[model samples]
Target: MDRTAAPGQSHTTPSTALAYLNPRYWDERFSEEEQYEWFKDYSHFRHLIHSHLTPNCSVLELGCGNSQMCEELHKDGATDLTCIDLSHVAVDNMQRRLLSRGLKDIKVLQADMLELPFGDECFDLVIEKGTMDVLFVDSGDPWNPKPETISKVMATLKGVHRVLKANGIFISITFGQPHFRRPIFNAPDFSWSVEWTTFGETFHYFVYVLKKGQRSSYEDIPVKRFEVPHVNLLHEELESEDFAFLINVDELNC
Candidate 1:
């Protein structure tokens, strides 16, 4: 949660080399004894999720790391919940965790978000927290992504769109701002209503609610500006270590 790094300051390093793009890189990371959750826990956004979620809805969490979001959701009376990740280690570990809790109802699968294996209109809700941000990091530069990177990110969204039932919601919690992340959700063929909420003072995080089959025309979109109070969320020295390349400071620069 450290936020001292300047805009676009977080960059890929040799130690974490290609970890954003390669599944093997994540498999090795998840294989280690230590466990890490990308950002804030499920409690922070549970109300938002619960507000839109209906009883007995089929929920799919994309890139569900070692986080307890799925377990907590299952405990909160959500049945038919499925969690997926590209790393087998992540999937296996989550499965064991659920088994230990005697929660065999929740399904954990090793699958790629880019090419989802589900049938069309299979899920009532699809949630992603920081998964799309990781994909943006792998796309070279966040401000200006390469063609293939944009395609990959769009393809992932298309997959999500295809699998979602009519009027289904796709909630994304990300460090990316409106300007950087809005375009991806505004594709011509896709029909989605994008609404965002920003949290935190100096270092902000966004929760984007995308409602499928509810398209908001480009002209109707409004410009948003965020103001920082010049306060530090983390110690200056721990900024680089804490952020780990996923935090985007572009808003701070602007």
Candidate 2:
């Protein structure tokens, strides 16, 4: 939780405060030789993704940021894989890595998450890892999100909703709690089934599985029965000493 700059890292400034919102910032960050992982890798959550994925499932990863999750998916028999990021630099880097490894089937592109170029209902799965959390950092207030922050997040969700096939699954691995993220998935046009798992002991994170359409038998339920409403709440479910389970009834219908 240290916000101060490290020995070589740049100091925070007005421009740098919301750097994650800018493509140039990510380009510069990924241009460095050292790789950084925001949270756990695909190995930790491979079962969750694989359980919902078919061998030939079309997968899309939003804001991939040089992560190797797609490569793992490819090795695991997912053939139609695509990854998108706002930074061309990151995309190029990923392309080179994939190419060097002979992973030609996985496609990498530079695109904004809010305005995905893909047609409607094209993908069987859309996966996000730490992408929305970056938006929260860009908002300058993780707890009290600004209007623009919510707008950008909603736009990205809408785009994901449009691109996913009926019953397609969207899995997001994030540090955000259900209270902060559930409303974004509670759309009237689509019914959703959501479940979350907690990882790590002291510094925990959550993996949220959001399935489109009515609650299905394939979906996993980890928590006791509860409903998730659409209304925004201040400081709700923000503090936790031990890991907890929360569900959105509006989405889970359980």
Candidate 3:
């Protein structure tokens, strides 16, 4: 109800923001086969990681909804995998989908990303799709509580940083602009750099390939460089935010 509570309001506290957000609401929405289809169908993300992911790699799919990316990854050669979702109903459906195929290496858990039940650096790769965007759409304005979205995501990123091996990677996809930026003010202990820009009409998602330690091994996927026209907008008028590039993964590694 309170949108403009304050800038830099503590979004990390589970009680403060996440408590008000309900996973059941999301579950009800995604319960439909159509919703499941949209979330699972990720051509862009798959294109980015198809070369990097290999078999026998332990992968963690954060916000693993009623999607098949995890299933596709398993089909592609991944052996050990852990999929987590905020909704128990969604997780149950995911498990059933895998079970129907006689797959056994996947484990689905109903847990909040803000507070996961896992150790540090435990995964080789962490994947997020449609999860962050959902949060922005769900959180009401007036308070314009989207900053909490950044805080929650960074907390999840911090968790990814801790569990991933030095060579491990994290990839997240969200909708926004080219130079779009949000405040990750809560995570001082973790050092994660990002490279995200606009792609397609009305869809600009960043592929955050986060790694622990340093950027010694991380590299951006080979691609051409391009820029989109800047549609200047006041921060207040935009329901969603967008921006331009400051750096890329290659630049960070160098």
Could you estimate the TM-score for every candidate?
0.81, 0.76, 0.66
lDDT per residue as tens, model 2, 27-121: 77677632344465677767767787786899999988767778888888889999998888888988998999899889999899989999999
Q: What are the candidates' C-alpha RMSDs?
A: 6.3, 8.4, 11.5
Runs in model 3 deviating more than 4 A are 1-20, 38-40, 138-150, 182-188, 197-202, 215-254
Best first by lDDT, ranked: 1, 2, 3
Instruction: For each candidate in the order shown, give its overall lDDT on alpha carbons.
Output: 0.72, 0.68, 0.56
Candidate 1, residue 244: Cα displacement in angstroms equals 7.0
Better of 1 and 3 by TM-score: 1
Off by over 4 Å in 2: 1-17, 138-144, 215-254
Give one digit per residue, the lDDT tens place, for model 1 in 1-254.
43222243332222432445677666765665334555566666677677877888999999997777887788776789999998898899888888988999999999999999999999988988778776655455455676887888899999999999999988887877777678677767578888899654544668899899888566255445455333223333223333333434222211
- Report residue 34 deviation for candidate 3 (angstroms): 6.8
72 in model 3: Cα distance from truth in Å? 1.1
Instruction: Report the number of clashing residue pairs per model.
Output: 1, 3, 14
lDDT of 3 at 20: 22
Better of 1 and 2 by TM-score: 1
Per-residue lDDT tens digits of candidate 3, residues 114-218? 776888667887877656554443333312344665566567667777777667776765543323332331135555545453334443455555555553223
Scored against the true structure, residue 183 in model 1 reaches a CA lDDT of 68
